[model samples]
Target chain A: SQTIHQWPATLVQPVGSPLSLECTVEGTSNPNLYWYRQAAGRGLQLLFYSVGIGQISSEVPQNLSASRPQDRQFILSSKKLLLSDSGFYLCATSTGTGGGQTEAFFGQGTRLTVV
Target chain B: AQSVTQLDSQVPVFEEAPVELRCNYSSSVSVYLFWYVQYPNQGLQLLLKYLSGSTLVESINGFEAEFNKSQTSFHLRKPSVHISDTAEYFCAVSDDGGFKTIFGAGTRLFVKA
Candidate 1:
């Protein structure tokens, strides 16, 4: 079974502090990984997506960046945490074969609270 | 570019009542549609998807969605809902061969007793 594991399930960071959230996938190789930030009423915002090692795609200009150093490891980071950066962060993985991508499998998510 | 729009923001229904959540999408290329359910404080889970072939797809949990290409819509329906069904539902769309998947604003379904 494919599984996504994200760490720091909940975090309380002070403004201007640095941030790092890690996610790892098991039971699958070369899967597409994504980072999403969900704010109240705004739905899941696609922050970044990575299809392979050292490749990252930023969906929107924001205070965050993503990196895929390994095939199954994806990380979300920020140099400085802004108050507006507080939200639930989710990590998901999906496998694609010839035609299209499959449904995503998500981690428990990290709830970041920038104080 | 592709985008998704879930027509309803919230829907309140009693247990065992039928419900339909509307979704519409826009894409310049052939697309794939999906519905995901997120329980409170939990990550989202895939409920169903429409890739090709049949326009209608059903989940193991009795939820069904029909993809209407002409209307650019994929509406989810269930004959009856239970209290356990209360959750936020998101409609998503992605272009064929694209890695970026866009999600709708979401519809919160409140199944009351």
Candidate 2:
């Protein structure tokens, strides 16, 4: 069975502070990893997705960035957090088949609040 | 550009009542459609998907969606809904050849007792 782990489960940070959210997938190798943000009443917004290590595709221009250091490890980072950055962050993985038919599995998610 | 539109922002239903959430997509090429459910303050979970072969697909939780190629719609429905089924439902589409999945604004299913 494949599982995804994300942390810290909840976070409170001051504005203009640096932020790093980690996610890792187990029981799968070379899977497609993604970073998403969920705002209150808004739909899931794609932040970044990586098909392999050192390869990332950003869906929107924003204050956040993502990196794939390993096949199963993806990190979302921000140099300085903004008030708009506060939201529920999610890490997801899908089979690397590239057909878009495979289901995407999600982690429990991290609640980040910027004050 | 390929896009998905969830017709209703919220659907309120009494427990054990039937419900339907509409979705439509626009894509010039072949499309793969999916429905995902998100509990309050949680990540979205895959409810069902439509690739090929069968136009109708079902999930273990009694939710079903039928892919309508001609109409460019993939509407999710359930014969009866429970209070546990209250959640946000999202419709998404991926070009059969593309890796990125575009999501709709989402519909909130509020099941009342």
Candidate 3:
């Protein structure tokens, strides 16, 4: 069975500090990876998605960026955190093929608080 | 481009009562629809999906959804909901062409005992 791991499970960052969140999937190769953020009482917002190594698509223009450094390793980074960046960040993976039909599996999200 | 709309932001029901959460999508091409449930402070879990056949799909937890092509809707329903079923439910849609999935704002299901 495939599983996704994300860390740190909870993060507290001061304003203007750097941010790095890592996601790694075991038991799967070449999977589609995605980064999403959910504000309190709001819908999940797509931040970025990667199809392959070194390939990433940004959905919203913001203070965050994503990278696929390896086939199953994805990272979300920010040079400087903003107060608006406080939210729950989720990393998810889906089977790569047959577009949109395969269900996405999610990791335990990181609750990020930018103070 | 594809989009999803979950009609209710919150649905409150008593435990063991029937419940229905409505969802609708808009897309030009063929699409796949899904319902995901998120427990408090946990990641989203796939409840059910409607891809091609039968127009109806069911989850192991007694939740089911029917895909209506003409109505462009996929509504999730459960005959009797439990207090454990109290969670946030999301409706999402993706095109058959491998595009990214777009999720609705989500509906919070509050099942009171």
Candidate 4:
């Protein structure tokens, strides 16, 4: 029962505006997508990862950008927004098939707040 | 290069008592250890994982972790803990073929009754 669907959950945006955060994974398909960021107390912070679809991988470079057009869809973009970019944005997936995906599964996060 | 070292950022314990959350890790290869739980805002759950023939790993709620590959450590215990167990315990590392997963810097279990 793989199911991850992050969304607005909570956002405020404003600093330079422009950021989209959406993650989808209903029952898995070609799973192995991640993008994490949890700053406030600090801890989780990966950035982006995908193993299919358009494929993308960036461990930390700044502005933020991730996309996996379909195949469980995963998107976390930003054209400008910065104020440290706010925090608490997560979306993970990894269950089986190919390296067993590494057993990761998360979602239910997204609390950006940049003003 | 994999690295994880959760040096206890906060722990209050009380409920039924007994609690320990400390992890340490560094890799030059062979890796795969995890313990994640973050209840307070949700997300982050797999409470147990060690990848091979159990060096002691059990989590169905009772929580238990023991994988000391010569003391690279993977501590996380709970002889009796409740109060929902509080939350915010993370300690992960991956390198058995890689998929990138290196995290630590978390440990905030505060179970009080």
Name the candidate that leads on DockQ. 3
TM-score ranking from best candidate downward = 3, 1, 2, 4
Query: Mind giving the per-residue lDDT tens digits that candidate 1 earns over A1-115?
Result: 8988999999999999999999999999998999999999999999999888998989899899999999999999999999999999999987675345668889999999999
For model 3, the interface Cα RMSD in angstroms equals: 1.5
Query: What residue runs in model 3 are displaced by over 4 Å at the alpha carbon?
Result: none
Query: Model 3, A22-115: lDDT tens per residue?
Result: 9999988888899999886678988999889999999989999998989999999999999999999999998747566478899999999999
Question: Which portions of model 4 miss their true places by more than 4 Å?
Answer: A1-16, A20-33, A37-49, A56-65, A68-75, A79-86, A90-97, A102-112, B1-17, B20-33, B37-48, B55-87, B90-108, B111-113
Q: Write the per-residue lDDT of candidate 4 for residues B13-83, one digit (tens) a residue.
A: 89998888999998876777889999988888888999889699898989999999898998999899999
Per-prediction TM-score of chain B? Answer: 0.98, 0.98, 0.97, 0.33
Interface RMSD of each: 1.7, 1.7, 1.5, 9.2
Question: What are the candidates' C-alpha RMSDs?
Answer: 1.1, 1.2, 1.0, 13.8
The alpha-carbon deviation from the true structure for residue B1 of candidate 2, after best TM-score superposition, in angstroms, is 2.1
List DockQ for all candidates: 0.62, 0.63, 0.70, 0.15
Clashes of 2: 0
Q: Rank order by DockQ, top first?
A: 3, 2, 1, 4
Model 4 residue A4 distance off true place after TM-score fit, in angstroms: 23
State in Å the error of residue A38, model 4: 5.2
Q: Residues B1-113, candidate 2: write the lDDT tens digits.
A: 88888889999999999999999999999888899999976778899998788999999999999999999999999999999999999998877676777789899999999
Cα displacement (angstroms), candidate 3, residue A87, comes to 0.5
Model 2 TM-score on a 0 to 1 scale: 0.96
